[model samples]
Target chain A: MASSPQLGFTTASGLEQDLAKLIVDSLRLEVAPGDIDPAAPLFGDGLGLDSIDMLEIALAVSKRYAVELRSENRAALASLRALAAHIAQQRTS
Target chain B: MMRSTDSQMAPVPTARRAFAPVAAPAYPLVAHDSPGCTLAWRRDRMHSVEEFLRSVWGLAAQLPPKRYAINVCKDRYLFAVGFAAALVARHISLLPTCRAEEPLRRLAERYSDAYVLTDHDLDTSMPSFHVTDHARHSSGSMKIPFIPADRIAAIAFTSGSSGFPQAHAKSWGSLVLGAKALGRQFALSSSPPRTAVGTVPAQHMYGLETTIMLPLQWGWSLHAGNSILPADIRTDLERLGSPAWLMTTPFHLKAYLSERTALPGLEGIVSATMPLTRSAAQEAEHIWQVPVHEIYGCTEGGMLASRRTADGDAWTLCHELRMRQESGGTWVKGGHVGAWLQLTDRITLRNRREFLLLGPNYDLVKVAGKRASLAALNAALLRVRGVSDGTFYWPDQGRSGNGRLSAFVVAPGVSRAAILADLRRFIPVYFVTALPRNATGKLPHEQLETFAEQVRHSGQARTIHECRRESFETEARRGFSQGARRDE
Candidate 1:
C-alpha cells in the first residue's frame, strides 16, 4: 500500500493510510488520503468534520472492518492513528 | 341575575384585587410536579429538578447584561440550562439554524447586543460566555422563577431566500402551550415518565419541541448527549436507567434498522424532520418492538399533528389546535399557534381534527400528464431493491437548459441502468457514494443544485443507454428492435 509520511514524523502506517482513504471516501472530503496527517485530529479543528460525518464514518468502518466504533469509546476517533490502533486491537481480540 | 349583581357589588377590596388581572400572567419555569424528579441526564448522572433550577439561577446570575443570548450549546442538558437561564435573566434566546461563520456573522449584524452562550470555545467575533464554566452548584433557595406569559422567550431563525436569517419570535405562553399540546398528543401522562433521547439537535424547532420541551413539560428526563450513530445511540440508551423515548428523524431510523442496532429500554420512537416511508416505519416497529410515531410541523410553528405510522396515514391534530381550509391552503390556529398560520404544505382536511398531508406545495411535479410529488418519487427510489439512499432532482429548465428530471443514488453493486429500469423511466442517473444531506438529514435545494452542477461537470452522470444496452439487445433478440420502451 502507498503510505505518505508527514514532515518531521515517521511514515504513515498501512492501516493509517487505509483509514485516511476510508474517511475521505466515506465523508467525500476533497482532500486526498496521502495529504491527511495521521496524527491530526479527525474531527472539529483538524479535519473540520461534523457529527453527520462521524455517523457516516462509523457506518463505513463497521461495514468494512466489522469493528464497531461507539461514541462511548471516543478515543478511537481522536486521530487516524488511534482509529487504526483501535481497529487492530478489536480484530485481534 | 339580581343575586349575581349583588355578589359583584359586595366584593371587598381584597376580592376585587383577586378579580383584577395582573400586569401579565406568570408561568412557572419548570412544569414538573416534584423537586426530586429527574430533569436531565448528563452522561450517566441524572440531575433532579431542584438541582436544575439551582443551576439555572446560578447561570442567570453569571450571564452578562445582554438583550439576546445566541444559544449554541451542543449538550442538550446544558442547552436547557442556558435556555432557562436566559429566560430568568429576562433575555431572549436567539436560535440560529446553524453555527457556521456566515450565519453567525449575519446574526451578529442583526442583533448587535447579542452574545453567544456556548459549552466550549467557538470561533466567533461576538462576545461569548462559556456555559460549562459557569455551571455552579449554588446553595441558594430552589425557587422556580415565574416568567410573564407575554414575554418574548426566544427568537428562532430560518434561512430566508436572500440568505438572511428570518426570525420567528415566540412568547413564553405560546411555547408552554405548544409543549403542553405536544405532551398531550402522545398521551405521555398515561404511562410512567420516560427519558427523551434524541438524535436531532436541540436547536432545530422539531428537536426543541420534542426533546427539550416535551420532557420538561411532562416531568421526563432529557438525555444530554446528541448521539446519531447507531452504535452510539445504543450505548447511550443502554446507560439510561429509565425507559426512554427516542426523538429522531427518518434518516437516523433507517440507519439503525439497517444495522439492526440494539436499542434497549426504548418505549417509543418519534420521527420527524422529513417524511418517513411506511415500509421503513413498519420495519422499525417490527424490529424494535416500539410504536413509531411521526410528527408533522415546520420551523414557523411547533408540532401541530402526529400519527403512529403503523396505525394509519391521517394525522390527528393536537387537541388544542384547530385547522381550516381557506383559499386552497390549510391554516392552523388556536392553542399554541395564536395567529392563523397558513401552512406551506398542500393538505387535505379529513375533518375538523385530522388531515392527510399531500407533501409541500412546491414539491408538486407533473410529468406526462400525471401529478406526483418529488417526495413520493424519492420514496419510490428508496423502495427499489439494493438502493441504499437516493433523491430525485428536478433541475430548473431556465438555468440548466435541461428541464429533464435526474436522480442521484447511493447503491453499491447496483448499476445505473438497473436503477433507471427499476424506476421505469429513462433519465440521467448518477451513482454517488453519498448524498450531501445536512446534519438534520435534510437535502437543501441550494445544496442539491450545487451537487447536480458538480456531477454534470465531473462526467459522473450517465444516461441509461450509455450505462447498458443489454435490455435493448435482449429486445432485439426477441425481434423487437424499437429500442427499450418505458412501461410508463
Candidate 2:
C-alpha cells in the first residue's frame, strides 16, 4: 500500500520532506514545499501536473531516489506521501 | 514486415485464405462471406460472415438513398457494417474528426442530403440511425454489392490548421488496396486470426483503415468497440480470446502504460495519430511485454510507413509505396497515394527501406497529436473579446504531459479563468499566462515563465494584459524574434 502524503502523516519524515522539495524543484513549481499538501493529488486539481510533468517527475525520481520509476507503478505517484514511500521502498541509494 | 517481435499477432500459420477473383469485370468491394472465415468478434463469440453481411444489408435497406452518409458508429463492429452497407447501397461514407452534432449537421447540410450513422445515444433529431437495431436482421442470402473501382468509397475530412476541415476523396480502389498494403505491414493479411482493439474513434482515417476496412477486406476480427481504460481494454482483449492486437494512439498508449492494472498479454500495439516518444514506446514494451509499432501517416496520405519504435527511429516504408526526399519534404507515390504527395515531415533517407522522422515541417507546430499553425492560433487569440491588442506566443515552459499548447495572453480586465474558458471553446490550450508587453509593443516569450511563476505564487492570477510600448507594430515585430515560433 502507498503511504499517505500529509503534513503530520508519517511523522513528517526527512526523506518525505526531501522528496517534496525534489518534486517542487524538478517541476519548477512555485509553491513552497510545506505549502503543497503532501496528501494532495499530484496530478489533476491539486498541484495540477499533467502527463508531461509526470514524465519529468519520473526522471527526477530516477536520478534523486536512485529508483526506477516504471510506468506501471502509478500508485507510487498518488501523492507526495506515496512518492516518498515509493522512493524509500524502491530506492537504491 | 521489418521484424516479427510480436507474440500474439504472430504469423503462426493457419490455413492460407486466398481472395479469388470475381467472375464479372465489376468487383464487389466487400464480400458477403470471405471464403470460410469469421467476420468479427462480439460478446466473446465469432460473428460469421453471413451474419455480418445480413447486418450490412439490413442497415443498407434503412438508409435513405443518397450520395453520402456520415459514418460515426462508435462501435468498431457496427462501423464496419455501416461502412460496407454504405458501399453496398452505392452511398459514399463521409467521415469527420468529431462526432459532435454541429459538425455533423454542417457536413450533412453541405452534402445536401445525408444522415448521421452512429451507435452513440445522441440528443440531436437529425435524420440518423442508431445502428444497433440492425444486428438481429436475418441473412436472406449471400448477395454481394459490386462497386466500380472509380467510385468514391469514403470522403475523409482533415481538421484544418486555420479554417474549415478539408475533404480528401478516396476511391474504393485506393482505400481497399491501401488497406491490403497496411494488412501486410500489420501481418493482418495472412491467417492465424488476430482480433484488433483500437482506442481511436472510427471517423478518423487511421481508425477507418485499421478497424473497419482491414476487418472487412482481410480475414481479421475486430473487438467490436473502442477501449479506453486499462481494465476495460484487458476485459475486451480477454473476451477476444488471445493473439489480440491493439490499434491505438500514443495519447491512449501512454495513459494505458501508466495504469497499475495488469494488462493482458497481446500480440502487438500499432500506434498512430501522433508520434510515439521513444521513452513512452520503450515503457509500453517493458510493461505490456510486446512490440510497439508506430505508424507515420497523415489523413491526406493515409497509411505510409511504420516503425517498430523500440527497435529504432527509422521507419520502413509500406511495401506498395515508393518514396524520395526532395526539397525539404519526402515525396511519395504509389500504393494508390492518388498523386505524388509530399509529406510535411522532414525525413533523412537512410537506405531504400528506411528513414528517420526529424520533426514536423518548418511551418507546423504540433502539440500532443493536434497540429495547428501558430499564425492561426495567434489570429484567433486577437479576435477574442476584451482584448485591445494581444499576442499568443509559444513559451518554452508550461506544457504538461498532455501536450496542451502553452500561450501568453495580454488581455486587460480579463481573468486567466475567462481567457482560458473562452479560448478553450475556440482552440485547446494548456497553460495561459497574462503578461504585459514591453515598451516596444512586443511580448517577451522568455518572461512567460516568470509570469506563470508569479501566477502560481499568487493563489489567484487576475493579472491584466498591460503594455509599456507606445509604438505597437514595430516592437511587436522586434519582440517576436524566435525563428522557430515565426509564422512561416
Candidate 3:
C-alpha cells in the first residue's frame, strides 16, 4: 500500500500555495491545499495523481498563469514547489 | 500463372518433412527501403531510418534475457526503438495503458519473467533496463533483422468487464498488415511520407497503430514528444519540415477548438478513443482546412473502420475487412483482425461496406479513452470493506463528452477519500441508506434514476449541470436512453 502524503507542515505560501489550490480545484481533490506537502511528488505515490490528472493540471495551470506546461519537461511536475519554480522561471523568461 | 513452391519443398526428405510444421514466412523489420528517410523527430532534430535501425540493433544486443518486456518509454522515438529491440531479441512487449504501481504489479505478477524497459528511472520493484542509455549506441551491426511473421510481437491489455486485465496478443504479421490497411484506408500509402504528431501516448493500441506502426511501416517520422498543450502542438507543427497528421482524441480536439489553437502544416487529423461529436469535427475541419476522420475500433482489433465525421455518420470499413450482424450483435473479421470478434458497441449495418454505430453497449462506459463497465466498477466498489450496497450511475449520455460517473454507497463509517483510493478515481460518492434494488436484486432503470435524483436533491451533492434536469426529462420520455442498461 502507498503511504499518505505528509500534511500540515510549514504553511505553503506564495505561488506554491496558489498552484496547490489550483490543482485541488481543477481535479476536485478531497484534500485541502495547505495540507498538501509542497515538496512531495505530485504523481505516483505522493498524491496518487494519474495521467488524466496531469492533463487537468496542465490545463488549469495554462488557464490561470498563461504558462504552457509542456509535458516534455517532466521535472516541472515533480512537486508543487517544482511547478511553482517552473512557472516563476517561465514568467521571468 | 499460378506459382507454387511444391517442387522445391519435395526435395527435403519427404517422410520426415511431411510431418514437420511448415516454417512461417519472414519479413524485414523495417518495411521502407530508403535508409536516409526520416524515422523520428526528437524535438527539432530529425533522426533517419539508419539511426533508428542502429538504435534497435544496439538496444537488442544489450537487452537482458527476458521473455517479456514491459515497455514504459515516455518518448515515442525511444518507445519505438525499445519495442523493435524487444521484437528483434525474441521477446514480447507487454503494453499496459496504466502506469500506476497497482497495474504494474498485476502485470509483473502475471508475466513472471517480465522486466521494465523505461527511459526514466522508474520506482519499480521489477528488474529494469534504461533504454535511453543505449538508444544512441551505434557499435552493433545495423542490419535490419527479418522477423518471422508468426512471432508474437506485443501483448496489449484492457480492463475487462470482469475487472481483471485481459491480454490481446498480436503477431508480427497482424501488426504489419493492420498498419498497411490503416494506411490504405487513409490513402497514406500512396501519399508522400508525412510526420505523425500524436497527442496520445504510444502505449495505447490506437496510438500504437497510428503513431508507431503507421510511421514505421509507411516510412514517416514520429514526433518524440507527447505534448497535448496547444502552444506545444503549434510549436511542434511549425518545426516539422513535412506535413503532419495529428493523432488525437475528442478531449484534446475540444480543448484545441476552445482555445482556437492554430495548427499549421497539418495534412489531416485522425481522432479515436471516443466518439467525436460531428459539430466538433466539422468545426475542426473548417478551421484547420483539413479533413477530420474518426476511427471506430477496440484494442482487440486495431483500426476496423473509419469515417470522415464532418461528412457523415456512416463508417467505411477498412480494405479486406467484413462485418455482419449475427444473433443481435456485430461481428467483424478479415484483414489484420484474424478472427471474428464481437464488438461492444450496438451497431446498425448500413450495407456491406459501411455501418452506423449506435453507441457503446449499455454496460460499457468510456471516459477519456479509458473504458470500464459499470458492472466492473460496482464489483470493485462492493469489494471495499465496510461497504454494504452500492451502484454506479451513468446519468446522461449526451454529457459523456465531459461526463463524471456518480456512485451511491451504503457505507456509514467509510470515508469518501478511502473509497476513492480503492477505486483509484475521483468520483462523486453519495452516501445512501440503501440501494433501491428490485426483489430480484437488480437495479431497474427508472427506479435508480428516481432514487439518484432524490438523493442528489436532499444531499450536499452539487449539481454538475443545470441542463441535467432537462436531459433526465428527455431520457425519461424516450422510455429508454441509448446508454441505459436493460439487465442491470
Candidate 4:
C-alpha cells in the first residue's frame, strides 16, 4: 500500500483514486478504477489504450483542471500515479 | 522502329505549360529578400520558399546516394519543394500507403536509403532532412531535365485500414497536368483571396494537391502546419484573415461544426478522405455561412471532382480526364492517357464531364453468398438510437468459413440490446457478426490479420454471440468501475 499524505483525502493516493476513476470513465476502460494499479502503465500492456484514448484523456484533463497536456510529453508519464501528480501540481499552481 | 531520341529528352510543350505558375492579379507573385521557403516559426524570423529548398538540397547533396525519400511534413510548401528538389536531384520520392510504423519499416526496406523529410526535429534512426534551417543555399536553376512523362516522381502510400499499406506512383508530367486541370476548373486564375488552411496532413492526396500543390503552382498562401483541434483551426483562420478556404476532411469538419464556436470568414471548405455525410455538410454551411465544397479524389487518381453543395450528386471531372464505366460496372477511363488506371469506386456517369460516385467497390462484402454493402451496414449502425459515431469491422474469422460481419460502435447512452435490436432490422441473423472498433473509429488491419491467422490455426468458428457477449461485459465493467471511482 502507498503511504497516505497529511491532508487525509488530499494525499497523492486520494488524488490517484479520483484521477483513475476519471480516466476510466472518460476513456470507457474495461477494468475497474480500483483494479488499475497506480504505478502500472495506462497505455499498451497495462490498459491497452491507444493514441485516441490519450487524446481523450488529454481533453478530459484539460477540461477538468484547466491544464493543457502536451501529447509529446504524455508518453513518458502514462501512469495513474504520474497523472495524479501532474494534476495535483497544476491544481496547486 | 527507330525510337526518336528527342522524345526521351524533349520537354512536352503542353506539359511544360502545365507546370507554369498561374497568373493571379489579386495575389501578385512577389520575390522575397530571403531564400528558401520560410515557415513562420517565430514572430521575427520567417523562412522563404527559396531558402527552404536550398536547405533540403544542401542536405540531400551531403547524404549518401539513395534511390528513394519519403516526406512526412504537414506543411505543404516544405513537402512540395522538398519533393521537387529530390526529383530534380534524380532521386525517387516514396510516399508510403500508411504512416503506421510497421508499414513504414516495410516500405523503407523496399526502397534503399529512403529518407523521411519532417519539419520538426524527430529523433529516429531513419535518415532525415530538416528544411527548417534558413542558412543553406542551393545551386542555380539548371535547365529542367526531361524525364519520361510516365516516370514516377512521387509514390503516395494509402491509409491501410483494411490491409497493408500499398504504394501508388504519381508521374511528374501527369501530376502537373492534373494540377493544371484543377487550377483551371476552380478558376485559380482569379487569385481566390482565401489563403489555404488545411486540417489534414499534406502527406495525403487531398492535402498534397489542394493545399500544397495549388499554392506552389498557383502562388496562393498556405497555412504552415496541421491544425487538428477546433480552437486551433479557428485561431489559425483568424490569423490568416479574410477569403480563407479550409482544406479539411469529413472527420475534422464534423468535430469543427460541433464545437458551435464563431468561425472566421471563409471563401469555401474542401472536404475529402472519407465520405461526407449530407447532414454534416449542411451543418457546416449553416455554421460557417459558406459553401462546403466536396472533393472526390483518391490516392491513385489525384483530384477528380469537386461539388459546391453536399446534396449535389454530379461531380465535374477534372478538365483533361474523361470518365467512362466499363461493361462490368467498374469505372474505366483513358483520356489524358498517361497511365492505365482502374478505380476502386463505383460511379454513375451522367455524361462525359460529370458523374455520381456510389461509394467504393470494395466496400461491398458477401456473407453466406449473400452480398451486403459495408457502407449500408455502417449507415444503419449510425441510425441506431443514442449511437453517436460507429464503424463496422469484419473480424478475422470471416475470411475463410461462413463468418458474419462484426461492428464497433460508440454510443453514449445506447444499450447493447437496443443496438442489436436496431441492427437486426436491417441485417439477417447469420449476416450480423462481432464489431470491434478502435478509439479513432478505425480498425487496425494488423490486428485483424492476426485474428484471422489465429482463427485459421485454431480452426474454430467464433460466433458473433460470443464476441458481442464479451464486448457488452467489457463495456459494463468499464462503466461500473468508472461510476464507482467518480462516486468516491
Model 3 C-alpha lDDT per residue in residues B1-488, reported as the tens digit of each score: 11112111224676788676787666566665677888888887988888888899889988999899999998999999999999988899999887767778889999999999998877789999998889997675566677777889999977766567779999987888898888888888425778999988888899999999999888788899887878789999999989999999987888788777899999899999877889999999999999899998888999999999999999999977999998888999998998899987778998999999875334656432345767777877877777888878877642443446788888888654445444433356677788899998877767877887898889557332322444456556666433412111
TM-score of chain B of 3: 0.82
How high is each candidate's interface RMSD, in Å?
Answer: 9.8, 8.8, 3.3, 9.2
Candidate 2 local lDDT, B56-149, one digit each (tens): 7787887887778888887777887888788777788998776666777778778977877778787676778777877657853445555666
> Per-residue alpha-carbon lDDT of model 1 for B1-488, expressed as tens digits?
00000011223477578776555566677767788888888887988988888888888888999899999999999999999899888899998767777668878888999999999788888999988877655763478777777888899865433223468898887888888988788777624678999998888788888888888777888999988888789889999988999999876787788789999999999998767778889999999899899998877778899999887889999898889988887899888888899987778988888899874233544332233456656766776668899987887651112365678999998644446555534356788889989998978777888999999899897765665475555544666443222221
Candidate 3 residues lying further than 4 Å off, grouped into runs, are: A1-21, A37-39, A72-76, A81-93, B1-14, B19-22, B360-375, B381-390, B397-403, B408-451, B458-488
Candidate 1's C-alpha runs over 4 A off are A1-48, A72-75, A78-82, B1-24, B360-488
Give the 10-residue window scoring lowest on summed lDDT in candidate 3 chain B. B1-10
The residue ranges of model 4 lying beyond 4 angstroms of the native Cα positions read: A1-93, B1-45, B74-78, B97-101, B118-149, B159-162, B189-194, B241-243, B332-340, B359-488
Backbone clash pairs in model 4 (N, Cα, C under 3 Å; residues 3+ apart or in different chains), count: 22
What's the best-to-worst order under TM-score? 3, 1, 2, 4
CAPRI grade of model 2: incorrect
Considering TM-score, which of the candidate structures 1 and 2 is the better prediction for this target? 1
Candidate 4, residues B1-488, lDDT tens digits: the string is: 11111123434478677775553112111112223333322212344555444554565465447778777665555665567666655577776533546555677778767887666675467887775542245563322233445556787766333233557777765565666666676665423334677866677667777776665555455677565655566666666634567888765675566556456867778887656777788888887888787877767778777776556767887777666667645453443334556666667778888887764223535432223456656666666666676665565444322344655566756555556544432122222133344686555566655654454466444344554675468667676332111000
In terms of lDDT, the poorest run of 10 residues in model 1 chain B is: B1-10
Predicted model with the maximum TM-score: 3
Candidate 3 accuracy as lDDT:
0.80
Per lDDT, the best of the predicted structures is: 3
Note the DockQ of each predicted structure.
0.26, 0.05, 0.24, 0.10
TM-score of chain A, all candidates: 0.85, 0.81, 0.85, 0.81
